[model samples]
Structures are given as structure tokens and as C-alpha cells.
Target chain A: MNIQTKSQFVAVASITSELSAVMVVAKEISLAAANAKAIAFRAGDKAKGFQPITDFINELAKETIDLVTNINVYALSLYRLTVNEYRRTVAYNKFDLVVKTTEGVTYAQSMQAPLENAKISMQNCQRQFKRDVKQLLDQLEAVMHHARAARVIAANSRIEASQAGEYLQSLQAVAESVDKAAHTIHDNVQRCRIALSLYRNS
Target chain B: MKMTKIYEGSYQWIMFGRDANKPSNIIDSNQYAVRTANRCLLLEPGGSELFAPMMAAVLHHTPVDQITDLFASHQDPDVISSLGLWDQALSNAKLHAPAIWEGYLRHFGCESIEYVPIPDNGGTIKLDSVELQLIPAHYLHSPGNFHVYDHHAKILMSGDVGSAVEAPGAPMYVDNFDSHIEKMRYFHQRWMPSNQAKRAWIERVRNLDIDILAPQHGRVFKGDDVKRFLDWFDSLQVGIAV
Candidate 1:
């Protein structure tokens, strides 16, 4: 169960971890593309058309992974902000309880100023958390946009492979693999977007 | 941050360095903490860039409030630039540094800490029941440097005395002395000015029964390796300006 204070943070953290899994997929796609390129190089002129498709797939995987990793950095900021907010809230609550319980005491009268200051500090933390979360969501959306761009690149690679005729029968497998990995990255980022959207609404 | 226990007694001496997470742009530096039952003393706790992670690492061993004192070797940013953050975090903690660097280090934002100036010859810091000596390490590299020597633990926190420029995530202790020479050679020759100062430091330290020669940048020299380092350092000519 997600605590109300950390619900958005928990959601963002999960999205960040999910993005890590997508990076693994990207790495595998990169490896497969490299293998395909090696085979194309060995075939020489026979598989000349297939080499460019492999290069495109490899480039797409690298770009997707880089963008997702960048988004994870913003997610980390949200995590830190959330932790700070939780700490500030705890401090404020502790001071509030003390002020309420010690009403009419001289020390309590003096503590009121600091207690009000703590409240203001906590309010500021909440405001910062909201602002950072919005920024993180925008960054995550950008990552999703990049993932979609990778999918388009993959689609183009597949189209290029199909155009190679009988000479690039082996290239079709590599193209399909790139397409699958691209779909996985795009779909994973979409899921992360949905998760962040749920937190934003909540 | 990887922490290793060099000495174990009623008062323990722990070395905190070889941090893989530290920013690459900054030079790698070591942080040592001496922990007693009641109080803790952090020695040369590195720069402002490392304050958060280093404190997080320190919490693994001792509580923040228990950190009664902070000892900086000199006014180097890599040595105690994080003094300000530590000042804010550890209330009632006093900073024990060389008297010469007292005014200079105040620029690092040490407003809260009651700075106790160590004299030129050096002084003793008694944390509860443990007494550690702040031995004079004048200009091995820094102008006004002091190293911590835990008498009971037989561990000398020799700041930059046996420092090396090894890769991040290198082993904590020197396993092979011969191979480690290359790492420390250039560092000592270039950074350490004055061969006379080097000879003076070596002569002073020779009398101490240092089982573990822990430095601020690289690996700790334990057992026979301590003598090997001392002998090797004595032979090496320093302050050769090209």
C-alpha cells in the first residue's frame, strides 16, 4: 500500500525500475544488431543493403536507452524531494504536537514562532514536490516520445529489409527482432506514462 | 563509500574512502572516523561534493550526534571543504585543525563549529575516554597539515603521507608493494614539495608503532607494508620541479 505522502514517489520509483528493465531489452537489441552487422560484413557485397538496417536498429536502441536513462535521473530527483517532504512533515508534526500539548506554558509561547516557521517550511517542501513531480512527468513524456521515434526507426528498418529481395533473407530475422525490442521500449514507456498520470491525478 | 576497520579496541579506527559513487570530476580522497562508545571523531572528511554520501556512510557505523569532533589535515578542499555542512549537521561538534589554516577554512562556511586550533607542534584530542594525537605534518603537501595517530589502536591516520592516484574501486589495502609504487610515485614527487619536510615527517613517524599506515587518498599499508612504505618513501627524492 502506498502512503498518501509518498504515493507519487512510489509510482515514479516503479517507473524508473521498469525503465531499467527496458534498458536490458535495448542492450539485447543492440547486441543482436551488432551480430547482424558482423554477419553482413562477412557476406560482403551480398548483404550490402542489410548492413544499413542493422546500423539503424543499433542507433535506435542506443537512443532509446539513453533517453530512458535520462528520464530516470528526473525520477531520482522526485524520489529525493519526496523523502525531504516526508522528513519536513514529520518535523512539523512533532513540533505541532508539542505546541498543542504545552499550551499556556512560557516555553510553548516561545515555540509558537518556530512551529509556525516549520509549518511554512513544510508547505514549501510540498510545493516543491508538486513542481518537481510535474517536471519529472514532462521528462517521462519526452522519453515516451523518443521511444515512439525509435519504433518509427524500427519500422523503417523492417521496410528496408523487405526491399532487399532474395539477397537479404537473413536480415528479416534481425529486422523483426529490432521491431519487437522497439515495441517493448515504446510499450514500457507508455505504461510508465500511465502510472505517472495516475499519481498526478491522485 | 567503502569503510574498513583498521583497528579494533574500546575505541575503533575506521577508514572511509574508495567511494565509487563520488563524482569523477573531483579527485578521489579518503575520510576516516574514530568511533568510541560515546563519541565519534571524523578526520579529513573530504569535500562539499561528498558531504551527503559520506554522512550516509558514517551513519552505517555511528550516529550523527555522537560525532563530537572533526579534524581536518589542512585547508585543502579535498580534506575538509565539507566542514560547513558537517557544522550544520553535528551540533556541539568542535573542529580541531591546524591554527594556521583556521582563518582560511572559515571561508568553507564553518559558522557553527567551535574551531579548536592545534598548535604548530600539535595537540591531543581526548574524545570521552579515547585520546588521539594530532601529530604535525607540516608541508608534506599542504602548508599546515596534521595527521591523527590513535595510540591504543596502533593506527596512524597519515594524511597524504602515503597517498596514491589509483583508479576508483581499487582494493582497500596494498596487496603488492612493488606494483603500488607507480601509483604513488608521480603523486608524491609532484605534490609533495620539500624533500627536507618529507625526511622530517618520516623521521618523526619512525618512532611510532604504526601497525596500519592509513593515508587520505589510497590504500592502507598494514603489517610489513608499513615499513616497506616508510623505507620506499625515504629513498624517493621529492620536490623536483621540472
Candidate 2:
């Protein structure tokens, strides 16, 4: 493979791997969100103030999962497009040898009746690939947005858990776990965006 | 694809193809490369399907970037289907083919290589130190065709001109000229398309001093077989298809 193709492959692989990491974080935060809800329910009247924060955290976890799901779908498309383009590059290299063989003048050099159509098609596919990459970034950004909001809700839940004397330790532990998961999800999303910037020149 | 050294010295000629791994459906093709110290010229590198194996075979001999020139006798799929892939691999290489098929072959996605168009009259290329002739062999099959000639080796890389439609796993060179006629006769008759053009090409090639008449398909013709082929081809009526 050419250097350009190698670099592009590495970039795409990095983004996909980071997105998978984000999925794991989302899943963990969702479990923590559920646990926070259970704790709030058990605390009954004492944890009334904590109920709203846990509800908000639960909603944000679901939103993050939904956005990440969409991001994964778009990333899969991006991977396929990138692989197709690389194959095109490889095919182009092999056929070039026919012309290199003669080392003379070619008759119908510019006459690309079929190639013209293929070029247009390839350009369209490339445009779609770019648009898909942008859409994936948008989705990642949306997930990150929710992750940040969840972190804020988790902080509030921790404060409210401390106020509820009965289930202070369990409520604070779930809140702490939710906060860490959200932070991890946010960091992974940022990594994905950086990885995607490698395609800017494309 | 396999690369076998046909000649070795100050310059070299390596034959690639007749790949066992090639799909059963596609016609088998032979690809050749002429390598000098500073440059290597690839001849009729074959279709896109042959690209990976052919490159693997070539890489076993030389680095991909060392290939500086590409030559296609015509626009047939078996002749030049791998143009796009080569374009990606050898960005510094240039393609030389008949001027008539320039626009047509470009459809194979030739974006990088600079095209040095060959006129109908034919021309010469300097491969580092060796000067090779692009002898015109138009209408042997395609409307525009060429054959590469190496005077030092006295070898004629006859594109489709002396090609034979042999079955799979056939020998690389003709050992019996009489039996080989069966493999070549129908292909020349139906594909050559113009008896007048055939005779003209035959008359021109007859004057050249060739020890090995190497064609794109079937086998190479050597020594007496060269003269035997010319005499036989001259008498036969081609372009018989209506």
C-alpha cells in the first residue's frame, strides 16, 4: 500500500477503536444511572431532592447511548468507503503498468468514455464519505454534550446523596461511578474528533 | 503470477503471468518487463484481476517504484485492465501507447502518469541506455497496436500480432510449429480484421533481425519457427469474420 493509503487506514482504525471505547463508557454510565434511581426509590421521603438529579442522569445516559449508536452506524459506513477508495487506488496502480510497458505514444490516451462516468461516480462516493464523516462527528459531539450534562447531574446527585443520611455511602458511590463514566465518554469523543481531522486533507 | 528471467546481463527481460491462482473464467495472459539499470519498462501488464499477483511477482524481482514506463499494445482488457492500479503504485511512471486509444484507455483511471502519445508512425524510447523501438502493428486486432523491439537481444515483443489462443497450462514456447498452428489460426483470422493491414505489418516485421518472436499469448517462437510463422501467416487469409 502507498503511504497515503496507510495513513488513512490508521486514522480510520483509531477513530473506530475510540468510538468503541465510548460505547463501553456509555454502557457503564447507564448501569450507574439505574443504580442511582434504585437508591433514590429506597431513600423514599429523605432522598426526595435527589430524585430529580437521578432522573436527569438517567435521561442523559439514554441520550448518550442513542447518539453513540447512531455514531457507530455512520462510522461503519465511513470504514467501508475508505476501504473501497483504497482498493480503487490499488487497481489504478496495477493497470498503469500497461502504459509503462511500451514507453511510446498512446493513441486514445484522453478518450475515457467509461472512465468519465466512473470518475463522476467515484467523486460522488467521496463526497458522501466526507458528509458521513461530518455527520459522525456531529453525533459524537451530541453524545459529548450529553456526557457533560450527565457529569453535572452526577455532581448534584452526590451532593443530594450526602444530604440523605440513610443511603449516603451507596448513593455517593453510584454517583461517583456515573461521573467517571461520563468523563471517560467525553474524553473518547474528543479523541474521535481529533482522529477524524486526519481526513480533512482528503 | 510468476516472473521468470528471460534474459540477464546489462539489461533484463522478465516474463510475468500464466498465474495458477487466476480465476478459471478469464483468459490467461503473459506480461513482460524489460529492465535496465536506471529504468524498467512493463509491457501489456494485463487486466485488473492480474494486478495483485503480478505486483507480487514483480516485487520479488524489483521495487515497485523502479518501474518507469508502461506500454499497452491496444485497449483490450487482457492487455491493459490493470492501468488504474499501476497508476496508484507508480506515480512517477509514464504511459506510452498508440495515440488513437488515448481517450479510451484513460477511462482505466490514469490520473498520475504523464502520457507520451505514440503516433501512428511509431517511435523509439530510451530506457536509460538501451533504445527500444515502438514498431507499429495497427489492426492486428485493435485499430491501434504496437510491438516493442530490442535490437541487442534481437527479441520482438509482438503484442497480439503472433498471439495464439491455447488452452490452460500450455507450454511457454512453441516446440512444434506444425501443431501450434491450430492454436493460432482462428484467433488471427477472426481478430486480425484486415488482411491488407496484416500483410503490411508482416512485411515490415520480416525485415527486422529477430531471434525470438515473443507474443502476448500462448508461446514464444524461436529460430526457424520465426520464419515458419511469417511464411505461414503471410499465405493465410485473415479478417474472415463477416
Give the lDDT of residue B51 in candidate 2.
76
lDDT, candidate 2, A8-72, per-residue tens = 67877787788788878877877877787888899998888988887777777777777777777
Where model 1 places Cα greater than 4 Å from the true spot, the runs are: A1-202
Model 1 C-alpha lDDT per residue in residues A1-202, reported as the tens digit of each score: 1378666666768887888988898898889789888867777776676777677768867876787788778778778777666655654565555555554543345445545666786789777766776776787677666667656766665665665656456666776676677678768877777777764644
Candidate 2's DockQ is 0.05
Positional deviation of residue A147's Cα in model 2 after best superposition, in angstroms: 34
Complex DockQ per candidate: 0.01, 0.05
Worst 10 residues of 2 chain B by lDDT: B56-65
Error of 1 at A139 (Å): 42
What digit string (tens of lDDT, one per residue) describes model 1 on residues B5-113? 8788777788888778778989988888888888889998889777756765666676556778999988889999877666545557999999998899998767668
Q: Estimate candidate 2's alpha-carbon lDDT, on a 0 to 1 scale.
A: 0.80
Model 1, backbone clash pairs (residues 3+ apart or across chains), number: 0
